[model samples]
Structure formats: structure tokens, C-alpha cells
Target chain A: MSHPAKHRPLIALVALFGLCLSVPAFAQFDAEAAENTFKDNDCHKCHHATKAKKGPALKKIAAKYKEKKLDEKEAIKHMTAGQKVKLDDGKEEDHKIIDTKDVKVQTNVARWMLSH
Target chain B: MDQRALILGFSMLAFGSAMAADPASIDWGKIPATKLTLFYPGQSSYEWLRSEGHKGASSETARGDSCVSCHDDAKEEQRQGAKILRGNHPLEPTTIAGKKNGHVDLSVQAAFDAKNAYLRYQWKTQNPFPGNEHQYLRFDGKEWKVYGFPKLDKVVQEGKQPGIYEDRMSIIIDDGKVPGFAKQGCWLTCHDGQRDMPKQFTKEEVAANALLTAIKKNDVRKYLPDTRTNPSDWKTGKSVEDIAKLKEAGAFVELIQWRAHRSHAVGMADDGYVLEWRLADAGKDMFSGNADSKTHQPKFMWDEKKVGYKSITADQLRKGDHFLIREQNAVPFDPNAGWKEGDMIPDYVTSREDAKGSAADNNAIANWKDGMWTVVVVRPLGLANSDDKALKAGGVYNVGFAVHDDNITTRGHFVSYVKTLGLGAKADIQAVKLP
Candidate 1:
């Protein structure tokens, strides 16, 4: 009778832990997976969290998009279809090309980059 | 009896089989496969001169290497360097041969940035073969991408055959070939209605086209960082003294390329004698204007009212007044490889042998009919050799030489030289024999 009373709290805690493990851990997009995707696809070649390259810096990508109120869907669609962006000399360049399928991942990377 | 017959039969079978296989299949003469090379300036990756056994590089070699060792085959078709070459055709050796390299000046690129892409075609000679096309390259944000090679049905508008013609070709980048994106994967490839209008473009233009094609074609799998077949695996020349300096950078990007099919349409005309000149020992600001001139052109500085060298540059003459001094030998710098035949290379494509370095007493090669050679004359503004004791700031020199066939297309050289010398784009420098 005394042993049963002592083990009751421990058994209750184990049941709660099992329930937690059964559900999927979700926090929007997976950052590491998206980053690897960007690198393998050459996105990282021109972009870096802290540095800039032939393209604009990606760290500020999230803030720019957020300010523009572009969500995952809108961002991916824009990237896959190139737009005439303002070049350094203020010329219009109709040359960027990443697709809509890459949006969520790109957005997550952008957000993470902005935060980090 | 059966065993002895079987042995004999096997030997006979092997011998007969080898004989039957077309003798043409094997190139007993060892001719290089004709392939054109176009390179991009920044991404030149060809490192080593040779991989495994093959030689002759259309790309840059490893750090601190030379362009001559592997391209040792001066056998006409594969000779390297440039000169004012003249050919008689076929056995007459009509195809001009010395090959040199150039760079894409960014100033030129800035001009093209306004357009989509540029295309080049080099026909071996004027005898119209079918199917010649120019390829285009498009640029992505960080890298250049290729738009599909629009099969330009043979450019049939007949222009003068021997005359050089160059034009820019704009391409549509978003033709929708790449898988993921709308305007993503594109391409450019040199195809004429005919095949193999090979050019000796600087390794960068060749590499640039190759790299963009690889990325767009998704052939990136074969792009090992160390493969000679790829430009990224290329090596840099320690001293490609013959090649143009801008080519060492990225000037290839901004220029249009052309192949001068030998002229059957236009013969040497009388408007003005066309001559090709390569800037040898050309430096700006090294010499003070002799008679108080302000311009930098070598010729203009020396002659007050006289334009440029009436015939050649000031530094071209032999050391002494009478062209007898063996001190200044005639080496063709326009196509620097002209001076290059020794134990290293014996014969050019024309089968003319370079018995020895031309005798010091020799200036211009005189064996026009006996062998194949081309001579270029220079008209410099003012050049006194830096160390030549007999010369002063205003001392003018005249140097000219005939080296082994340089293979430079007179029209091609004129098109480029005219632009480089600030003579404007539409220059008409027809090749005429000048004394």
C-alpha cells in the first residue's frame, strides 16, 4: 500500500510524456531543410545571411517582403516568375528566376535569415 | 592435322579482320578534332595544361603555365598566334591560320547589356557550305544562362565572302525550357548550316558559354572542378604573351565574334590598301611627346602634320639606319607564335618547315612562293627602344616580318583593330600587298 502511493506521481508523469511525443512538432517552416535547399540550388551562391553578392542581400529579404505584406504564396509566385527589378544604375532588369514551388521554403529561409 | 589448321585459321582471321575495318577510321595523320571554344571571363576554371594524354587547350591552363607547350602542333590547322596571313586556298593554303586571344571589354559589355546576347560565326573559307548559325547567351542575376540555340536557317544573305562581317544577335531569355521556372533555363550554341567554324576565342568566352550551357542544360553533374574538358578546370597562362591583355580579364563578354570565310566575293580593291597591324610594344604615356604633341597614339605624336605611321610604327626599323643590323630580328608580335618554330615544332599545316630561328640577318621572311608565310608591317607614332643606345625619343623605326602562316583573317583583324585603335566600328581594311 505504501509503495503504490509513492509510485503514483511518476506513473502519471510518464503518461503525459507519451502524449507529447505522439504529435508532430510544427513551427511553420523548417529552417535547416530550407537552407540546404537554397544552397544546393545555387540560391546561396548569390545570397548570404550577412553578405551580399550579384543579387540583393537575403537577410533583409523577410523584412522587405513583410513590409510589402507578401506571404509565402505571393513570394514564391513572384520568384519563380522574374520581375523587372531596379538595378544599381536604376535600370529595370527583368531577370530573376525561382519558382512558386520554392516559396514556403524561401520565405522560411528569409525569415530565419532576418532573425539570425 | 586439325589442330595445326585451327591455329593457322585463327591467325588468318585476325589479320584479315583488322585489314577490312576502313583505314580512314584511324587518323594516321593525327589531326586535331575541330571544336570551337568560347569562354566567360570570371569563371575560367581550366587549371592544368594536360589531362591524361591529350593536348591543345581552348581554355586557360593552371596557374603560371604557358599556351605554347600543349598547342605545340604548329601544323596549320592547330597553330596558335596571329599575323597578317595570306593564303592561296586548299593546296594553295588560302585559310589564314595564326590564332590569338582577346578579352571582352566591359565598355563593350555595357553596350551589349542593352541588348539580350551576341552571336559569332567563323566560316573556314568563302566557298559557301550550308548551315551556319550564331549562338546567344543570357544573364541571370549572378550567372549567365543560355537561351535555346535558335536554329538560324543558314544566313543566306550573301555578303562579300572574303570581307569580314560582324553583327549583334539579340535572344529571348524566357523561352521556358528550364524545368522549375518560367524564364529559367536558356541556352546558346554556335551552329552554322555547316559545322566547325572554330574560333580561337580567348579561353574566357569559350568557358563562359560552356559554363552557362552546362548550368542550363543541367550538365552540371559532369562539371568536376578539375576536368580540362570544362573551363572551371582550366589553368591560367603564366605568359600568354601573344594573347591580347584585355582577354586576360573579361573583355570577351562585351564583344561580337565573327568568322571570316575567305573572300571569293571581294578581291583586293584600290580604294585603300588594307593592312593588318598588331600593337607590339604598345604603351601609353611611356614617352614624352617628341615635338610637343599631346595625344597618346604612337604615330600622331611623332609626325606633326602626318597622321600615323605612313606605313609602320617608329620602333619597327632595324637598329641601324640601313636595314642591315641583325640586332633587331623580325618576330611577328601580331600573332606572336610566328617566331616559334625550332626543334619544338618543325612544320606548319602547309608543311613548310622552320629549319631554325630565322637567321639574325633575316628580318622579313622572303619565302612566299617556296613556303607558307604572312608578313605584317607596322606604322608606329614614335618609339625609341628603351635600351637601344643609338635611338632618341623621336627616332622612328620601321619593323615588318613574314612569319609562318599566322592564320589571322584579315577581315577579322581589321574589324577588331579598327575598333581598338578608335578608328570607329565600320572599318574597311582590305588586305593589299604594300611595299
Candidate 2:
């Protein structure tokens, strides 16, 4: 993977420019709307941002999915499937299905949770 | 008029003016029953209801929206209860293994005469057997020790004691007083630091609390938020004098409880109010702790002559009635009365004659048949007592109902959201005037 010394600087500049171009696309997923949807569905009753309540914290969930090499599709499946989840208390119950069938809203929430 | 007719007329006048209204005489079939689904609340206290953890409803709760405002669907209580009873839900931590049904249907009927308001409640038991046995004093080989506790208790969880508690029906009434009661109902009185609730109070913390110390209370119980400077914290209670003023202004929710074991045998319900604490009214209640404070042995034992046994054994529980009514079957404990290892005595003793003042204001009669409890509580109307809610006709009051069943106590009960009860007026559950 060695690169020419003269081309390295140009490569760094192009990568920086690419990141700048993709920032708008990343920002297009409205965080506020995702949060409102989460709240509307009362998801925060079990899930929290940083601290673990009944369910795993969003950060821990994100880290788990990332470490497991899972994608947004897996997260979406979790939100839509209502599969049995083992809570922090070592008890099992069906996870709450997100209160929406709209793929875009589900994708946004899934991505928002993963972003944590 | 003739002499016999005059005497009859005089008797009728006396009966109309002086005698209390009989619940049996009231035609319950004619009165409409409001069907409310009482659900197990677990640890969802006032603090939990308003905390960010509540998510969608926290903002609405903060803005003074009633619980029924958003959870207005007919089956909302059943839905919430089912989730919580699945156990290890956000609201529930401890799961009772054999516990099934998350909700119970309470058929409530109200009727009012000139002197009393009769509230009849009917609900099926989760267990096949009625919960009439409470905690007991057990003789484990030599020394007597406490046995049987609520499922939520650590001892019961650890298998140190069996789950044994009485079924109870409770009503918390607010006569347009106690701010937020109409919106939040019993949640305003339930908070963190209460027993079996979230953020339960430590012994040191309870001992250090100024309000608890002043009141000489060892444990935290149901209390109004207005009693505390910070509505969410149990330790931040306002001054006793301030609470007194609140009581003077009639800003407390009246707590009336009919216990299956404690008060049922005596045909009474314990009366109390929530302010700085869940305190009994002005005087003594119908039931008191049966164990002696110093000796730790039971103060009363069943009269062998009356009940055919001095004390019951572990195997005798739920086989039949085990109440230790002082007037009916209890006698002073005799330490030398052929003590045995398997003997057990009731932890509480009930006495109708011992009750006094506002604490004795409520009367109740209940029967269990076909796995259902039919309880009728008779409350006097136009009560001028400081501890009472004065359930008068033409007045609507915010009422919250709770039923503790299937051998449980404390937070392990099914509860209802706030509903208006109008006595001879328009409300959520209207009480029809008697003929």
C-alpha cells in the first residue's frame, strides 16, 4: 500500500474533499425527527442514550452491532421484528416494535440509534 | 293517629334519621357499574411518571395531562399491565414465577342515600384460593420468627420465607383538593425512596430524613408531593407545620383500605390520609401489629376453645379462614401453652371495638365466592372530620382504586388511573341517588 511521497498530499486533499461532500448526505437524516419518533413510540422507557435502564443503552447497542459487523438492515429488522430481547435484568420479553411501517422513518431511527 | 301507628311512625323517623344506610338494602342491580381494568403498576411512581425515562408521556405529564388523556383507549390498562407483568420490563424488576394475569376487571357500582355512600367492588382473584392469610409468627424449632412475606421482599426472593400476604382493596379520594390528583392520581403519592419502588431508600437515608425523624417513622410510604420541597425527593420534605397547614386546607388524599385478613373479620376498613406520610387518621385503626415490640413473640393467639386450635401450622395456610380477630377468636398469647416447633400465629390482630375517631369512620363487608371478591364499602356522607374527604352528594371527587391480590402487598398491587366519581352529579362514574 505504499504511495509516492509527491502523491500523498494530493490523496489527503481528495479524501478531505470527499468527506466534505458526504457531510450533507449524513446530515440529511434528521436527528430531531428521529428522536421525536423514538419518544412518540415511548422507546426511551427502556432504552437510554448513555445509561442502561431496562434495555441496553443506545451506545452499547451501537457498539455491539458495530463490533458484530452488523449493518442498518439488522437494526431495522430488530425494530420491526419484535423479536424476544434479553433485557439488562436477565429477563426475556418481546422487544417493542417501532410504531411505524414507513421504511424511511424506520431507517432514520435505526441509523440514529446506530450513530450513538 | 292510633297509639300503635304513632309508635310505628316514631320508629320509622328514628330509623331514617339515626341508622346508617345498609349496603344490602341498596339495589345494586339497578345502579350502573363502571367497569375499570385495574392493572399492576409495579414501580411506576410519581417520579417515574414525570422523568425522562417515561419518554412520550413525560412531557404530557409535566404539562398536567391526565394519565387517561393519552392512554384513553379502553384496553390501555390491560396493554400496560401485560407488558409490565411479563417482568423485567422497565416498570417491573422482580418477577413472580407463578403470577399470571396482568390485569383484573373491577366492576364498581356506587349508590348514595341521605347519610352514606355505598361503593361496591367486584373482581376475580388471580389465585383459586382467596388471599386471607397475611404474615405469620412461626416457631422454627425453638424461637419464634417472622415467616411469609410479599413476593417483592428480598426474603421471599431468596427463598428464606414463603410468599404470604393478604388481599386488599384501597381507595384514594380527593375532593377537588390536592393539586395534580385529578391528572396524576395515585402517582402523586407514589415516588422514589418508597418501599419496593425505584431508588428505594436506604436505612441510613431514611434515618437521616428530617421529616421521617420528626414523625418517628422508620420507613417511607405513600406521601403527597406537596409535602416535599422537591416534589420528587422523599428526603426533601417540608416542615411538619407546613404539612399541618396543608391538612388544614384539606389538601390531602384520603386513603381507605379494606384488608382481607386485618379488617374484613372486624367488618371495617382502615382510614388514613397521605400528606407527609401514609398516616392513620386522628386515632387508632382497627388493626395493629400482633407481635410484641420487645419480645418479638405474638401478643395474641387464636383461642383454642373458640377456634379449636391455639395456633396454625404451615400446612394450614389457605385451607380455611386464618384471621386472628381479637373480639371473636384471639386471646392473649400464653407463652407456656404447649409450645411446638410447627406452630404459626397471625402477624396482625383486628378489633372493631379498638378503633376510634376518624380512623374508624369507614365500614365494609366482603364475601368471596366462585373465585371472585364482592366487597361493599360504606362511607359516611357529609363528614366534617379533618381527616376525611367528606363524600357528600352533588359533589364530584377524583378517585383512584387499587387491589392487592394473590398474596402480595406494597407496590405489588393492581391500580387504576384517576376517575371522577360524582355522587348525585355528572362525572366519570356517577353515583345514583337512592329512592
lDDT of 2 by residue, B1-435 (tens): 012233223323433444466675677899999999999888898888887667545655877878865565446687778878876588888878578888999999999988888899999998888887889999877788888999888988888889999899999999988898998899888888888888888999988989999999999999998899998889999998999999999999999998888877677778888988999998888899998999888899988887688898988778887777786678999999988898999889877778888898888777788999998888888888988889888999999999998888888899999999999999989999987
Residue pairs with backbone atoms closer than 3 Å in model 2 (clashes): none
iRMSD, model 2, in Å: 9.0
True contacts kept of each: 0.00, 0.00
Give the Cα error of residue B243 in candidate 1, in Å: 17
lDDT of 1 by residue, B243-314 (tens): 233233211111111111110001100000000111112222111111113321111111212222111221
* DockQ winner: 2
Highest-lDDT candidate: 2
lDDT of 2: 0.83
DockQ of 1: 0.01
Candidate 1, residue A92: how far the Cα is off, in Å: 3.8
- After superposition, candidate 2 runs with Cα above 4 Å error: A1-116, B1-18
